[model samples]
Target chain A: MDYFIELFFSGLTRGSIYALIALGYTMVYGIIGLINFAHGEIYMIGAFTALIVSTVLTIYGFPLLAVIVLTALAAVIWAASYGYTIERLAYRPLRSAPRLSPLISAIGMSIFLQNYVLLAQTSDFQPFPALIPEFDFMEPYAHIVGSSDLAILVVSAIVMILLTFMIKFTRTGKAMRATAQDRKMAMLVGINVDNVISITFITGSALAAIGGLLIASHIGQINFYIGFIAGIKAFTAAVLGGIGSIPGAVLGSFILGLTEAFATGYVSSDYEDVFAFSLLVLILIFKPAGLLGKATVEKV
Target chain B: MIFSKRMLSILAAFALAAGIASNASAAETIKIGVAGAHSGDLASYGIPTMKAALLVAQDLNEQGGINGVKVEVLAEDDVCKPEVATNTATKLVSENVNVVIGHICSGATKAALPIYRDANIIVMSPSATNPDLTQSGDYPNFYRTIASDDAQARTLVDFATDTLKVGKIAVIHDKGDYGKGLAEFVKSFLEKDGKAEVVLFEGVTPGAVDYSAVVQKIRRSGADAVIYGGYHPEASKIVSQMRKKRMKTMFLAPDGVKDDTFINVTGKNAEGVYASGPADVSKNPLTKKFRDKFMATEGAEPGAFFDNGVTAALALTNAIAKAGTDSAAIAKVLHTETADTPFGAVKFDETGEPIGIGFVVYQVKDGKFVTVQ
Candidate 1:
């Protein structure tokens, strides 16, 4: 029972991170109808930004709380900017072209960003300083999870709650929903669909940046290629949940994370991904849409 | 038609002149190719070998070169990848390098060896330690200054069973060719020794975001110690995660985890972790000489494979100096003659394994690897 609980929490922690990045993918797909393949690079850039800022701040002997907050702020801003720029430069230009064009551009943008960072910083794995401090209150439960894991869960939950609230209550949220539902109708309704799309990209990128910061600090290292794996997993989560559905993305992420954790725990770690994908294949075969995804009928 | 014929003659004349110029240059200098991961995550391991080759070449040239013929170094980056290594090998061969120093990772070395062998270029590695590289009998021209994984694994198992006295062990690997190969050897050696019972043997997907599930499994298995086989990036992650989870299980690993980067990354979690690396040669005057030279030039202490890099470079040059540019004679000299290296007087056996050079265990103490008695 204790072992089960531990695995459950581990899965939750992993799921929370995947959800953070998956939200980016689902949101971009929701608003612009493009997969934004470079979403993972945004997450990587976020981690790199956090890594640089935190290192310099720590070197200057700042308080841990200050360093953490400022580092996260820098990462979110930089990643969001990169996200905005990618959508503007890569996806926006081809918004009216064939759907495959923007998707290809997204992939090209992903590769371009990866190599850009590789050439700009290094291909080596830079050690990320421990930003989250050990909590004295959590010492008893340390055997099951660490301080960083707890922090990740709490921060992601709060962020998710805020995002949910904004989307449900705010004007921009309505505009985003309207844009996602029918871009032409929304434009006819004076929704300024372009701005809504830009906001969606920025919001998604910011979430991914937060994910990057947490995971990098959690893993204790970052490199140019770290984004690719995390991005792929989160994208899998998005697809598993129904690509354009917000709640579906989160649900898919948690399910994938828990499945991986339990599978690795009970079965063999060798086929961890195998179990995850097999589950995906099984679900897709039955539902055709993701777990929470609405079935869309294409007009013939 | 006459003008076109004259243009053809000019092109042929230029081609012939270029061929003669290249031949004259090839004769004037002995080209040594330094190939390895000068970029990518494993660049730390490969860069030192490149530096070692450069420094050795510099010293040899200053001292009237190899038998009065100047030595030139041609370096290539394999990124420690197998496919890239073949290209690196082909490029070196095309450059007509008389000998090659490295294809650092074992998998890359395995891929690149056929190219070097086909071209009859003797290739020596400072860090590629797969036993199959020597034992497979497929590549006669391959040699390494480091002990093979089997020998290193044996040392680790003996230390765990004899010194640490851990009876139950969990073996983990990154599922790469190198990591899985080393982990398998560790498991078999532990099982054969009968002193320690193998509790769990598993492979983890490299670059997985989290390893908590595996760590929990290790806890549930009730292993007294964990033997990990992989590079520092993954090792640091696992060790740190274990530390975070407050698991104090004894952690032991092979030389792949023995580097300053591991210590730097794992931070406090790195303490008391045992790793078997190339035997300590810090006290050797030759090692001190190279250490000072490297620090003075690069302004940093030599990294993971620096000693073995120096040894491999020294052995290659010494062989070429003794046997001239002939690959067969150089191979024979490498097999028979001893080269004074940082690893002490080193000579390769017929199988291209360094005879006396071996591994010793080191435990991370106060943020550095301290030799274990």
Candidate 2:
């Protein structure tokens, strides 16, 4: 029973990270109808930014709390800027062009950003300093889950709730939804469709940045290539939950994470991906529109 | 446009003479191809070997060259991939390198060996430790300064059973050619030793963000120790996750995990982890000379395979100088003659396994890997 609980929490923690990154993919897909292939690179840049900031601050003898806050702030801001720039430079130009053009551009941007980071920094894995301190009251339960895991879960939950509230009640949120529904109609109604798309990209990049900071700290390492695999996994999660649906992305992430955990725990880590993808295949086969995805009729 | 048979024969003979002339001139500058992953993730391992080869060539040239002929280094990056290794090998061959120093990582070494053999270029690896490279009797030209994974696995299993006295062991691998190969050896050796019962043998996906599930499974298995077969990246992740989960099972791994990067990446979580690596011979004056030289030149401590690299460079140069450019003579010299390196006087056996070079288990204490007694 203890083992099962431990696995459950592990799954939740993993799911939270996936959800954070997948939200970016789903949101960008929702508003702009682009996969935003460079979303993962944004996450990687976030981790690298956090790593650099935290390392420098710690060297200068800053307080742990201040260092953590400053590092996360730096990561989010830098990643959000990169996201905005990428969408503007790569996607905006190809908006009226064929859809495949922007996708190919997105992929080229992904490769370009990866190489850019590689040249600017290094290909080596740098040790990410542990920022999350151990909670005193959680000592007894530390055996089941570390303090970092708890922090990740709580932080992700809060971020998700805040995002939900913003989307449900804010003006910018309504603009985003309107733009997502129909870019032409939103523009016709004076929605400033371009601004909504940029904001969506910024929001999604911020979430991915948060995910990168947490996961890098949790894993205790960061590299230029870390974004590629994380991006692929989160993209899978987004697709599994219906790429354009925000809630579906969250649901798919949890399901995927839990499936990976239980599979690795009960069976073997060798077949962990096998089970996760198999679940995705089964869901796609049965529902054809993902678990929470709504099948829409295309207008002629 | 085609030549007649008589004219072709004459042309072929003239071409052969020209080839012989070029070969003779090539001997004046003995080109040593340093092939390995010099630019990618495994660059840490390969770069040191390349640096060592370059330094050795410099030293030899400084000392009036090898047998009055200047030594040269031609480096080609394979990025530790097998497919690229074949290209690296062919490139080295076309460059007319007299000898090859490395194609680090066992898979790449295995891939490039046949190319070197076909070209009759003796290839010595600084770190490739797969047993089949030597034991398979497929490549007589292949030699390595490091001990094979089979030997490494035995050392690790022996330590786990005899030193640590762990009875139930869980073996895990990254499912790569090197990692899976080492894990299989560990599993078989453990079964044969009969001191430890193999509780769980599994492979984990490399580059997974989290390994908590595997950590949970390890805990539930009740294993006294976990033997891992992979590089530092995955090993650091597993060890960090296990410590975070408060699992006290001993973590043991092979040379792939025996890196300062592992300790750095894992930080405090790296404590008490055991890894088998090339036996330390730092006490040797030759070792000290190279160590100081590397530090002075590179401004950093020589990394994982620096010693092996020194040995390989010394051996190759020593062989070519002693036996001239004849491939057969070079092979015989490598077998019979010894090159005094960081590992003391080093010589290759008939099977191309180095004599005297072996593995030692090191435990991470505080923040560094300390050699275990």
Model 2, residue B128: displacement in angstroms? Answer: 7.5
What tens digits encode model 2's per-residue C-alpha lDDT throughout B104-145?
989999999999999898999989977889999999999999
User: Candidate 1, A28: how far from true, in Å?
Assistant: 1.1
Candidate 1, clashing residue pairs?
none
- Candidate 1 residue lDDT tens string, B249-315: 9999888899898898788899999998877678999899888999999899888888888898899
State candidate 1's DockQ. 0.56
Off by over 4 Å in 1: B1-146, B280-341, B345-355
Native-interface RMSD of candidate 1: 0.8
What count of clashes does model 2 give? 0
Report the CAPRI category for model 2.
medium
Relative to the unseen true structure, what is the C-alpha lDDT of residue A89 in candidate 2, on a scale of 0 to 100? Answer: 94
Return the interface RMSD of the candidates, in order shown, one decimal each: 0.8, 1.0
